[model samples]
Target: MSDTRTPLSRARGLGSAKEGVHHWWMQRVTAIALIPLVVWFAISLVMLSGADYAVARAWIGSPLVMVLLTLTIVVGLYHGQLGLQVVWEDYTDGALRVFMIVFTKFIAVLFGLGAVLAIMRIGFGG
Candidate 1:
């Protein structure tokens, strides 16, 4: 077998882990998905700004609105998790990096579920 890597490359120990492309693609996909969802959400919020509680509740109670809201929450959480994971991976290492990533994921999931539940409660008139 022939060694193709240079001395610095071997010394630095930085090599492709074969997962970077997948991670990059996932980040991009989530970002693209968030664009329209966030735009819709922002516009909806603006339109609902002056509405009363009943009107707001009715808007959220709509099936389409509920579905879109759920999607927005879920995707936004996932996207945030991915970005935070990358930051942790880049800025920290060893146990702290692992812990940060795990903690970030936990918080994201927790908050995401909580938000969705709240949305569901309002949407279903619970």
Candidate 2:
């Protein structure tokens, strides 16, 4: 008699969850990228504590600051989306899973954009 149980029989969920591992890894890598950025950002804020608004704006208006801020926003948004996805997958299932994941991402994108805009507003005043 044949053993009959194919290798595929042991797997769970739809097809290969190929993107799952990629997403997981990306999230971790992005988080690692943010650590130094956040530290630098914090130190920058502390260093700028004595400066006036114009000086503060000039500091952040520098190309270096803009680039770093952009990187931080991208990494933060991606990390937030990934972290929320895990929570969503754990807490909700079926139709709700799709809804939660998409909704969470939508909200994250909006929040991230808002944060970036706020930073830009700081750097470029009214």
Candidate 3:
């Protein structure tokens, strides 16, 4: 077998990761998903604005609302991670870039888990 890649590509090694398109696509998809979820979240918050703590708790405890809120949290965190990754990649270099990318990912996951736990606690009336 013979390699067909251009000399410049072979030398530079700046070619595709094959995962870039997938990541890009997922970022866009999550962004689109967030539009409706954010709108629903905003409206839900507005409707609950004047309500008491119990009323807000009850609203969050509803199965449908709980699921939507969880979805919103998960998707929003994922989307934010993707965006931050791009920013870090573009603006940083070497160790700092690697550190920032890892740190961002870690923080995003931690926050997402915290959000999930909080939602579950409220939903289960704990």
Runs with alpha carbons beyond 4 Å of true place in candidate 3:
1-3, 6-18, 49-52
lDDT of 1 by residue, 10-122 (tens): 77665567343677788899999999999999999899999998898899889999999999999999999999998999999999999999999999999999989988999
Selected candidate, larger TM-score, 2 vs 3: 3
- Rank candidates by TM-score, best first: 3, 1, 2
- For every model in order, what is the number of clashing pairs? 0, 0, 0
- Regions of model 2 farther than 4 Å from truth: 1-15, 45-56, 114-126
**Compared with the true structure, what per-residue lDDT tens digits does model 3 show for residues 52-109?**
9889888888899889999999999999999999999999999999999999999999
**lDDT (C-alpha, whole model) for all candidates:** 0.91, 0.81, 0.91
Can you list the residue pairs that collide in candidate 1? none
Q: What residue runs in model 1 are displaced by over 4 Å at the alpha carbon?
A: 1-20, 49-52
Model 1 lDDT, full chain set: 0.91
TM-score, structure 3 vs. true: 0.80
RMSD of 1: 5.5
Candidate 3 backbone collisions, by pair = none
